[model samples]
Target: MLVFGHCFTKGNYTIDAALKGLCTEEEEELERTMMAYWANFARTGSPNGAGLTEWPRYGAEEEYMGLGVKRQMANG
Candidate 1:
């Protein structure tokens, strides 16, 4: 299982900010995307779904899916 810090960021980029309802549209979308990714992974073995970017498999490249204000792939 992979662990990430997607849902841990929000308006204030804090845990409390994530739980509150004062998040911006980007923050809200980030939360939604993260949830969908996790839900898809729960239903299937992979996090890739109909509209999401293909989550790359972890390997020597050491890449990861970034769930920040803007969604993108990043190298770890």
Candidate 2:
């Protein structure tokens, strides 16, 4: 299974730290993108911001951001 969440891992002396060095450049980029989204959401009510992929609001199309090897907007 293609599991995620490694990039979002936190804490100083935890499994996340131990596996921190194992992240590839792509994974690191993913982390930056996700962090940007979170920070933007915290600063504003929406996650959409400049220089990032446009995240559509949840609607009938069921669109969402797909965080993975390559981050992009996806729709169900």
Highest lDDT model number: 2
- In the range 1-76, model 2's lDDT, one tens digit per residue, is 2125575565644777567667777877877777788999999989989998888889998988887777777788
Error of 2 at 3 (Å): 10
Local lDDT at 65 for model 2? 81
RMSD per prediction, one decimal? 6.9, 3.4
Question: lDDT at 23 for candidate 2?
Answer: 77
Looking at model 2, residue 30 earns an lDDT score of 74
Give the Cα error of residue 39 in candidate 1, in Å: 0.3
Q: All candidates' TM-scores?
A: 0.68, 0.71
Q: How many backbone clashes does candidate 1 have?
A: 0
Quote the lDDT for 33 in model 1.
79
Task: Give the 10-residue window scoring lowest on summed lDDT in candidate 2.
Answer: 1-10
Model 1 lDDT per residue over 42-73, tens place: 99988989888789898999998877877788
